[model samples]
Target: MVRIREDDINEIRNKAGIVDIISRYLPVYRKGKSYTALCPFHDDHTPSLSISEDKQIYKCFVCGAGGNVFSFVQNYEKITFPEAVVKVASLIDYPLDYEADDVREKIDPHKETLYRILEDTIKYSMYELNNTEAKKQYLEGRGLDERVRQRFEIGYNPPNDALYRFLKAKGYTD
Candidate 1:
């Protein structure tokens, strides 16, 4: 996953017009002060998607689909948020690539090892949680479903030396 700076995203949002981008996907027409288009998100006989150029936003009254340009592109194109940002930047001819400072160069070298250790521990804990029925039951009792667990990488580390053994196996020094 590539990281896009917030400034670049905001710049694309500011430069691109909501109506223009939406119009590229579907027909947009002048309706009073705002623009109107048939909701592409849902089956519709009339124009229900209201696009406000003043506010730089769009909203579908019937299905409640709404957002700014990046979100609109994301939802409509079924692409990731970063992909949508890249697409929008391309649409308006905004340069997306910029040299970013190397963060690793400034951080303590030991920090990377610590991060790896923590990451490995998390992975081992997640494996334990999946294999342990009691842990799964406890998560369910707390209303944490599989979806939430997977989303948050929720895991458990048993009160044992398993984690230490796992780390040692991965060649981590004490």
Candidate 2:
């Protein structure tokens, strides 16, 4: 769970322009000064998606899927309202210092456990890739090409007790 400040939310909202943000999801055409696009939420031959640059709002005339930046992220990504807010904040480079309580209250307890488990698994996998001789052979035997490995930034960790020391320096513990 992570906390988000109200100021961060507002900064995200302001920086995330409606036309630019929505353009990534849908093709928009200029109709006078406003832009119009086919609504992604519904099937429509005529373009009904209208966006106002001044207001930073979008609305689909065919359907009622309309709101500010936060609503757009929430509906499109199918994430929680706070998650959407955080994503937007990150996209806009807004600094956030939220209390854990705020984020914990919003996140599902079951999902939180799963998320933590996945995070730990990734850490373990990365550690094994770097430190284990058998794992390195396995990757090589699997025909893992250098191009692919470089593309993914894969590297073998030296056979030393350095990862634990590194994690400790970073203030992480198992």
Model 2 deviation from native, Cα RMSD in Å: 7.3
Which ranges of candidate 2 are over 4 A from the true structure? 99-174
Provide TM-scores for the models.
0.56, 0.55
Report how far off residue 111 is in candidate 2 (Å): 22
Total clashes for model 1: 0
Candidate 1 residue runs with Cα over 4 Å from true position? 98-174
Error of 2 at 16 (Å): 1.4
Candidate 2 yields a Cα-based lDDT of: 0.75
What is each predicted model's overall lDDT from 0 to 1?
0.90, 0.75
> lDDT tens digits, residues 1-174, model 1?
547899998889999999999999999999999999999899988999999999999999999999999889999999979889988989989999843344325767699899999888888888999999998998999999999998998889889898998899999999
